[model samples]
Target: MPTPTPSPDELLVFTGSYTPDTGGNGAGLAAVRFAPKTGSLTDEPRVSPVPVSGASFLAAHPSLDVIYSTNESDTGAVSAVVRQDEEVLSPLGAPVSSGGANPCHLTVHPDGHWLLTANYGSDTMPGSVAVHRLDTDGRICELTDVAVHEGTGPVAGRQESSHAHQVLVTPDGRFVLATDLGADAVFTYRLDTGTGRLQRIAVNRTRPGSGPRHLAFAPDGAYAWSADELSSTLTCHRYDPDTGTLAEVSRVPATTVPDVANQPGGIVASPCGRFVWVTNRGADTVAAFRVTGTSLQPIGEVPSGGIWPRGLALVAGHLLVANQHSGTLAVLRVLPTGALSRPAPAAHVPSVVCTLAL
Candidate 1:
């Protein structure tokens, strides 16, 4: 039989893993093509021998020619690679240190001129957020500026310092938002497109003890949603799109606490703008929400049927979940009602897989 070719609109996922060291996570990469029908998948194309040890997170540029990875380690760094022609390519040069430890996530500016990273590390020393400019060749140029987060969250014991977990620029590219798990707040910053600089706007605090992680914006960009990893809840904020101000509107529990505490890592809105999905590490499941304007109501929760749900991506119509502990990837059918079912194209991976694509 001939190898299945991907659809014109089909998205291919690139993920990293840790399979070699039994004591350590595996070191491998994977490529899976998504199918639009019934939201299923065909097969996983093995692409391994990645340079990074623990490739935890990934970001694809808006322009779609380059991709980046966060090599999660105590010695944190970001690598930029291109997908030139039809091949998966390597970084144009060496990786750039994020100026902090365990750089967990990276995001590109909507203008495609700069790249930003969040460092999740220690309490006292905390972590820092750094900015990097991109060259004409789609490579990261220089480390522009770095900001060290100060102060602790409301939690007496846990929030002893700041851990910047995620950084994202608004859809409009006017402001940038960074979430601090230890600080329990989303720090808003103004982006300078030409100079590649970040200026502090305002630090919006979440409910006490709610360790904010990943964030998603509504399709119309009128509302913003944040997932609290420590608290297992989703907070809705009324956003002034022009001014970029966020006012907390409501806070709803995501499947109740103890079962969902380590939840809210990969939070993303479906491309159709009808549903939102968030991955729970503790529950090993993905929570589905119905999106009505800015209001979000929990509709259903589906088991990923794996050890831990780490990363999530929607390609064509299929929902892909990265199973960190089980050393495999799970594909699910996404219903029009925003529910998930039917697992297929499941395969064993090396370590914790973090998938991103063009």
Candidate 2:
């Protein structure tokens, strides 16, 4: 008998979009089937599951059976959807309140016990981080706790109040870190697994106006990098897992274009921990860097192939960028040397803000 060849992995890509709130054209959650080998996506995505407003960020369950998204509306909420098949998703239940206003980012606990959200408050509202208990079926049950952050950064218009942008879990699953764009701080918390509660451990302050937005940790949990939205910089930090503390290592510009208005978006560390990539919205580029033990050496940058690149995902050696303003997803090849090739023509999506691949 002849030997059989294995089929290429079919990448199931999930995207969240900004709806009426952000002047977005999206109707709801969208799904696309991507072929990794060809770097191509289905001509037209099947946008379904739910017609939610402000489904801006998404997080997948560890079991890959459920998906959660932040409903970035005046009354913040998190919605859950069950994965019915390769190309189908259905709402699991009614969205539950995030315990704050304008929830922007979320992540599932590695242990599959909780879902965490960062609520980016408006000018009159205060920012907060909320934890929700997850039932055995991966559906969100109730808001277990909400950790309200206090403080403001130096930027008057943008930092007049706390704006928690993202919530991320440590690789070890013992702690949770939330980045506050308006506060210019990364607040750390100890996760009580048994209770699904968040206990404030430490607050790591960044440069006065850095406006830390999103973070990515090294594979081994030794180091971490934060993408500062207001400052348009990437700050490296030495991560102490046991103590849940982050010490600044270095801060560098995320874009090579000098004096250009830049807003850094997503930050992702390569699986092997050799490289870190950050998206520059104003410059419409993806900046690549070589990671060397808490130090970042700029490698180069490649065009995002669209406008306002807000999200990035590394899947099967390819870098996928979600350009929110242009409403397209750009696929770029990631070379072994940590450089990126020119991105493929944009794939259509309406106000795409985040990407998740499985």
Candidate 3:
């Protein structure tokens, strides 16, 4: 008997891009449909109805028809949009200040009560994480709390000040973790859901000059992994959900050519929690690894099918890469052995930095 082919899933993907004012030619948030069977994307993307600037990152509400994005500007801001249908998005309200400079990443609380932003400060500014309240309509209503971090790594130019690159809530939804590239640390906090305040809990330090960028937790929430942007390395840790403590287990290169100028962009663990993947920007590749009880064994690496892959998402058994410099989205089929095939170009969206599938 032969295996039956699975029917394709119709996926609505939203892409975030750098705007003209940010040194790129992006019109703003763009939408495209993806066909899983053919590994193809809609020929043209539908631009957002309203103008948005520096929408470098986006996050979808866990259970609502709404999307949130970081403005990624000197005066940071975050915006919300309501999904009118499968194809259209309507602005929910005016953009709200993110309470810091150059806000880069944002995420919605698992309970859908709060929105969080990680601001990557410039030379003159300090990095901070801000929280906002989400209204019944899924719109951002007001600022709730802001936690500012102070520290620096050993790196000379890149670690001059604190730069929080990403904020992630634990799978149990009890704690929030922020990655600071400039500080070489992952700061842990307990979120006060009622007040939106963050209580500092723990600080997990990585190797000096590692420049921890982003992290993904295991499906069971027992482990966590981080992609180091500066040293081009990956670090694994045992995560204690109850205490919000991350204990380091191991560190390994994100790419085979470690001496090269490879910068890891995004890191994700497989849905089954058996595999982990990281995107290498300078090398333009995706590295795969086998996860074994909080330890990592390098699997292999494959071409990203474009230049400067910055963000990646796993959708419907496929891996999608947002190639920032090449202005293209690439799709790779995830094999049964937990490896990714060479990607095929899907769509062209200029200066794309983030991909969110809903």
Judging by lDDT against the true structure, name the best candidate. Answer: 2
lDDT of 1 by residue, 15-132 (tens): 7665343234666445656555545444445343456555678777776567787767777778887765443556667888877888888988877778899988754368678899
The C-alpha stretches of model 2 lying farther than 4 A from their native spots are 1-9, 46-49
lDDT of 2 at 202: 98
Ordered by lDDT, highest first, the candidates read: 2, 3, 1
The runs of at least 3 residues in candidate 1 whose Cα sits more than 4 Å from the true structure, single-residue gaps closed, are 1-10, 18-24, 38-49, 154-157, 256-262
Worst 10 residues of 1 by lDDT: 1-10
lDDT, candidate 3, 164-258, per-residue tens: 99998988878999999999899999989899988999888888899999999899898889999998889988888778888888988899955
What is candidate 2's local distance difference test score?
A: 0.87
- Residue-level lDDT of model 2, residues 290-332, one tens digit each, is 9876678999999998999999999888988999999998998
- Which clashing pairs does model 3 show? none
List clash counts for every candidate, in order. 8, 0, 0
The per-prediction CA RMSD against the true structure, in angstroms, equals 3.5, 3.3, 3.9
Clashing residue pairs for model 2: none
Better of 1 and 3 by lDDT: 3
How many residue pairs clash in model 1? 8
